[model samples]
Target: MIEVKNIEKSFGGNKILKGISTVFETGKTNLIIGQSGSGKTVLLKSLLGIHTPESGTISFDGRIYSELNPDEKRELRTEIGMVFQGSALFDSMTVAENVGFPLRMFTKDNNKKIQERVDFVLKRVDLTEAHKKLPSEISGGMQKRVAIARAIVNNPKYLFCDEPNSGLDPNTAILIDNLIREITEEYNITTVINTHDMNSVMEIGEKILFLKDGLKAWEGNKEEIFRTDNEAVVAFVYSSNLFKKVREAYLKE
Candidate 1:
């Protein structure tokens, strides 16, 4: 689990995150959602230790991230996995190589051991037959799968995805969300996602944090979000034409 307590940050003189606090539970999907410049990005980065909070505390499991020394920070780094916005797979590397890259970089295992790890993760993500394929040779969804396999191959305690479904068709986006949810539950990893997709919100939002500007405006699960009386959240939720239509139907019922 990860916890952010009374977090604050500033860039130049502008405060990016202000007194933000939330708990991201393990073995569940934790979503941070907001519009552009709403500080969700800053909060995500801060939790990842990419941006140090000006005055606050971030703890991964039980380790206080704000106070870690260099070696300890490196140890913490190895415990977390990140899936970037894009697939971020190496175009030149085959799928097997990409998924096994972490083991190669971090472990001193022999070729057989490496191959075994690679094959295990490949099959885990259902990409067993595509091991020889390059990133360009696979579909976007497959590329995301390969990225996920790579992210988990090292057996991280934490998993972070930055817009894991961005730039995908709606159907493909949902498929990716389901895959992430399944993996998170199976591995019991502390998973956090940065997104603006409402479909994802309703689909895998075991824990949701609603950020407006910098502060956390609200927090709840998927069920409570729709009935929230907060004006900002309602506007954000029903602003989409699709959601607006659904809201109308539900009210008429």
Candidate 2:
């Protein structure tokens, strides 16, 4: 689990995160959702140690991030896995090589052991046959699967996905959402996702944090979104005609 306590961050005197506090539970999909300038990205980056908060604390499990030593912080980073917004796979590397990159960079494991782990993760993501293929040679969905395989190849305890379903057909997007949720549950990883995709929210949003203008406007689960009377959440989530209809149907039931 990850815990946040009254964290504040600013840039060039523009406060981006203002006293944000929340807990992201383990073995569930915790999502941060908001408009383009709502500060979700900054919050995500802070959690990843890319930005330093001026106040408050972020704790993983029981260890506080701000208190960790340099070596300890580096060790903690090794336990994290991140999937970038654009399916950030190396263009020149094959799927297997990309998946094994972490192991080679972080561990003294032999080539055979790394290969075995790479093969296992590739199979887990159902990309066994794509091991030798370059990113350009496969479909976008396949590339996403390869990214996921690489993210998990090191057996990370925390998984962070930034818009994992970006630039895909609706069907493929749903598949990727399901795949992430499944892996989160299967490994009991503390998974956090920063996304604007409402379909992802309805499908796998076990925990939802709604932000507006750098503040947490509301927090709840998928079903609670429909029942919520919070104007900020309602206006943001039901902005589209499709979701408005879906909310109406859900309330009727």
Candidate 3:
């Protein structure tokens, strides 16, 4: 599990996160959602140590990141697996190489071990035959799968996914969300995903953080979103046609 306590972030003079406190539970999909310019992005980066929180404590399991030294920080980083907004795969590398990159860099394992791990992850993501293809050779959804394989190849305890479903059709997006949620539950990893997609929220939002500007306006599960009386959350929920239909269906039932 990941625990974030009293997190505050600022840039020059603009404060971003305003005393945000939340616990991302293990073996569940924890979503951070908000409109554009909300603090969700900053919160994700803050958890990853990409952005330093001025007055917050982020701990993985029990170890606080702010208290770690350089070496310790690097060690902590190794335990984190990230699927970036765009797959972020190297265009030049084949699918196999991209999936195996972490093992090659982080461990002294030989070729046999690396290939075994790589193939295992690829099969786990259902991309066994695509390894020989370059990232550009695959479709957008396939590229995201490759990215997922790479993220899990290292067997990370923490998984961070930033817009994992961006630029894909709704059908493909749902597939990716389910895949992520399944992996999180199966591995019992503390997974944090930052996204604004309402479908994703309804599908796998076991725990959610709703951010507005720089503050956490609401926090709850998918069902709670519709039942809440918070104005900001109400606006966010009803604004999207998809969620409007969802709210209607829930109300009618």
Candidate 4:
């Protein structure tokens, strides 16, 4: 589990995160949803240690991030896995090489061990046949799968996905969402995903944090989202007529 308390981040003149506090539980999907300028990306980056918060602390499991020494910080980074928004795979590397990159970079493991782990994760993501393919050679959805396989190849304890379903068809997007949720449960990893897709929310949102204007407007599960009277959440989530009908139908039942 990851615990964030009173996190605040700012640029020279503009503040991005404003004293946000939340706990992302292990073995479940925790989603951060907001508008484009609502500071979701900054919050995600802070959790990833890309940006240091001016106030408050971020703790992974039980260790405070600010207290970690240099070596310990490096080790903690190895335990954290990131799936970038753009399926950020190296175009030149084959799927096998990409999946094995973390092991090669972070561990002294031999070729046989690396290959074994790579094969295992590829099979886990249903990409065994694409081991020899390059990122450009595969479809977008396949590339996303490869990215996910790489993120988990090291058996990370914390998984952070930023728009994991970006640039894919709705069917493919749903498949990726289910895949991430399944991996989180199977590995018992603390999974945090930042997204703007409402379909993803209603589909796999075990815990949802709704942000508006750099503040947490509401926090709850999908069922609660439908039943809540919070105007911010209602306006943002049911902005479309289709979803309004869906929420109405859900509440009726």
- The regions of model 3 sitting more than 4 angstroms off are none
Which has the better lDDT: candidate 1, or candidate 3?
3
Winner of 3 and 4 under TM-score: 4
* TM per candidate: 0.94, 0.97, 0.97, 0.98
Model 3, 20-126: lDDT tens digits are 99999999899999999898899999999999999979999999999999999999999999999989999889999999999999999999999999998899888
| Model 3 CA lDDT for position 226 | 72
Query: Would you list the clashing residue pairs of candidate 2?
Result: none
lDDT assessment of candidate 4: 0.93
Instruction: Please write out the lDDT profile of model 4 over residues 1-253, one tens digit for every residue.
Output: 9999999999896888888999999999999998899999999999999998999999999999988998999999999989999989988899999999999999999999999999999999998899898898999999899999999999999999999998899999999999999999999999999999999999889999998888888999988999999999988999999999999899889
Measured by lDDT, the strongest candidate is 2
Q: Determine which window of 10 residues in candidate 4 has minimal summed lDDT.
A: 11-20
Task: Write down the lDDT that model 1 would get.
Answer: 0.90
lDDT by candidate, in order shown: 0.90, 0.94, 0.92, 0.93
List candidate 2 stretches off by more than 4 Å.
none
> TM-score of model 1 relative to the true fold?
0.94
Candidate 3 pairs with clashing backbones? none
lDDT of 2 by residue, 178-219 (tens): 999999999999999999999999999999999998999999
Runs in model 4 deviating more than 4 A are none
Best-to-worst ranking by TM-score: 4, 2, 3, 1
Instruction: Tell me the tens digit of each residue's lDDT in model 1 across 182-250.
Output: 999999999999999999998999999999989899999887786678898989988989887876676
